[model samples]
Target: MSTPSQLSTNADLRILQRNMAAALMQPLTRHDGLQSRTQVDFITPNDRLSGFQRLEIYARQYWFRLLDCLYDDYPALRVLLGEMRFHKLCRDYLAAHPSTSWTLRNLGSQLSAFITEPKARDVARVEWAQTLAFDEPQKKTLHIDDLLGADPSALRLGLQPCVIALRIDHAVDHFITAMKKTDADVRSGASQAMSQAPTRAAIIKAPRLKKEVLHLVIHRHENTLYFKRLTREAFLMLTALRDGLTLADAVELALAEADPTTDWPVQIRDWFAEWSQLGWFCKPSPQP
Candidate 1:
């Protein structure tokens, strides 16, 4: 029973809906789809409300939704930057890398990379690293005896599923600790006016180890990712061993860095046992 005019009105309104939906989900601008004025002004209802007035609702929501995604991904960064600076950073990020992602989680994948740009090249990597550090799911506690049956020198454990190696241009631990605070913008100590300043050594999830924290590597075995810190000697020894060097060759690699008078065989035996218990070695399948 509708007239031609009524049919035309329905068509125009449908087009408006299509245009608004596109604008909402992507980093589209007012002019990207239909002329903003056309969608805003050509309404079917003979009401006082203008078309632009109604479409403004969609426009505002678009910005709000995008900001929400960014907030979830970089809460620590937001805390450090404070409300005003953080919002500004978000705007800059949007301008540089519009909302092309369909899901919220992937929005921040480029954040650390984006920080390398002239606008944010400084705080980007470290901040992004802190947020993503917890993104990987952790495993359950594995008892030390879990690998007891395995021979000590035959297995080689690798990084856990929850661990990701990152090399932030900025020191990671300092950035995380600083952001973990309530204030966010308060820099660590008087020395940190700039990020390049001398900083604390790198350590992650250190508090969980329940002992003195220093440098070392982490890996998964028996449903848990265990950490084995290396002294310079330990790291050198392990690195040498990983390079296909024999036990003696590995010990020689570590000796120069160890206390000048340390015993070689004793250290190697202890290293072999500890490494074996940690699933750092596996037996060669007995000759067929």
Candidate 2:
């Protein structure tokens, strides 16, 4: 319906917008100059600043905001890598995997896989899982009574949306707990108290973390996120249930990997009781 001149204008506007977006994401030079691909005339020069200078301000601010989001999201990684190295890593990561989502919530979603350091990767995985646990919705808690008439042989269950099961090779949860407590103290202005807490510094300076296998359930309860440690048997059972196996089948899978001497029948009963009280189960969603 548009005339030739109007169509040309619309095309020009799209080009301008695309160029501006690219300019905003461009890496700045060491002197803070704009290394932009956008045409100089795209922005008007003001009395106090040139057009490129104005664009540079926007580019720097845009990058800084994204950098800040990652810095906050990956605090443990920041502490482990030190400020300089962490900042470098952030820049490198952003360059490789620029923001694609409108919400910054997903900015660090791929960070765990992007990181190559074993310890740092584990820490990132835990932190990211905690982030998901805190942000994801919690469903109605399936109480034990709801299953009173359910057949044991064919019973299937779903975990709460906020629940995440992880098997990692380091005590990253403990390390994260220490980091969180220290951060809380610093935020509360308890400087002297934090100074006396040796856990933060001790863990940071240790040459290598003692490797410990952990099977953990990260979940949210009453708006608070927590890491619940689980035995390998229980973790496997929960994982199988989460993957749509029948409760009987899930139990069999757990027992397969369980210790021969352990009384798993009793242990599984106790686990279900405890998990039910903690509100971990939900009605499985019907698959299309």
Candidate 3:
């Protein structure tokens, strides 16, 4: 029960809203700024501001809000790249992968793949894994006593849902820990100096980071996330189990690549006991 003119006005408003949203998401540059102003018509200019200028305000704020979200999600990456470069990176990343989810937590979900630098990509991978581990569902954990009595050949094990294993070229874990410490120190200093006049404090240098092959296990326990360094053999065994191999087969595969002189049986038994106690294994399913 609408007139043709009213229906037409509604359609025009919808199109304008869509165009404005699209323009706001683009990079706020001179070229894009002019393009956006030309594409959308605005109300008559008042003494205070022009239509384009008003749109520019909203556009700039939108971009800055997205940049802040990326900064919060990847603080270490931001530190590594410095402020200006991090800002550019966030802009580029957002242009490529716009937010598709209702929640902003998934903003950096594709960051590791989007990053070009190898070291940055490695760090992003670790950070992403930590994010995933933090959100993974809680499950009943296996106990040491359960493994101690099971037959090695017949046993089938499952890793905890919160466990994530990564093999990387750089020792990113050490770098992340160092960066966190630096952040903590800076925050502490700021808190202490709030009442006093600002003074030049000695700058704390970040630890020298080096590239070295590393295998890591990221997992969650009691709502806290942790990173555990693993030996090559241990990584292989755990990966095998994660891939659905029987315990005996996984142990054999691990030993095949391990040092021949080492006492593998004792080593594996100790490793299993430690892992079991840490609740790295998933609880067995109830019998049908």
- Name the best candidate (by lDDT): 2
lDDT for each residue of candidate 1 in 1-288, tens digit (9 for 90 to 100): 112333358776676566555444444343333234344333444387455655554555556556656765565555445566666677567767765656555666677665544323334543443343334444342333554574535543332233333322333344434445322232222321221211222322222111222344444444433334456676666665555555456666678656767776676667656765554543222333
Q: How high is each candidate's TM-score?
A: 0.48, 0.85, 0.77
Flag clash pairs in model 1.
Answer: 40-51, 40-52, 80-184, 115-121, 152-276, 154-281, 154-282, 155-280, 155-281, 155-282
| Model 1 spans > 4 angstroms off | 1-18, 25-48, 75-85, 95-103, 117-123, 130-135, 140-143, 148-158, 182-288
Please list all clashing residue pairs in model 3, or write none if there are none: none
Give candidate 3 misplaced runs (Cα > 4 Å): 1-17, 30-38, 42-49, 148-154, 181-206, 283-288
Please provide, for model 3 over 1-288, each residue's C-alpha lDDT reduced to its tens digit, 9 standing for 90 to 100: 111223258776676667777767877673435344344354346799887776666776666566656765676676666666666787799889988876666788999999989888887888778777777775787787777767878787888878999998888888878876222111111212122212222333545557999999988877777889999999999988877777999999888867889988899988998888888887534434
Write down the worst ten-residue block by lDDT for model 1: 191-200
The regions of model 2 sitting more than 4 angstroms off are 1-10, 31-33, 36-38, 181-208
TM-score of 1: 0.48
lDDT of each: 0.48, 0.76, 0.72
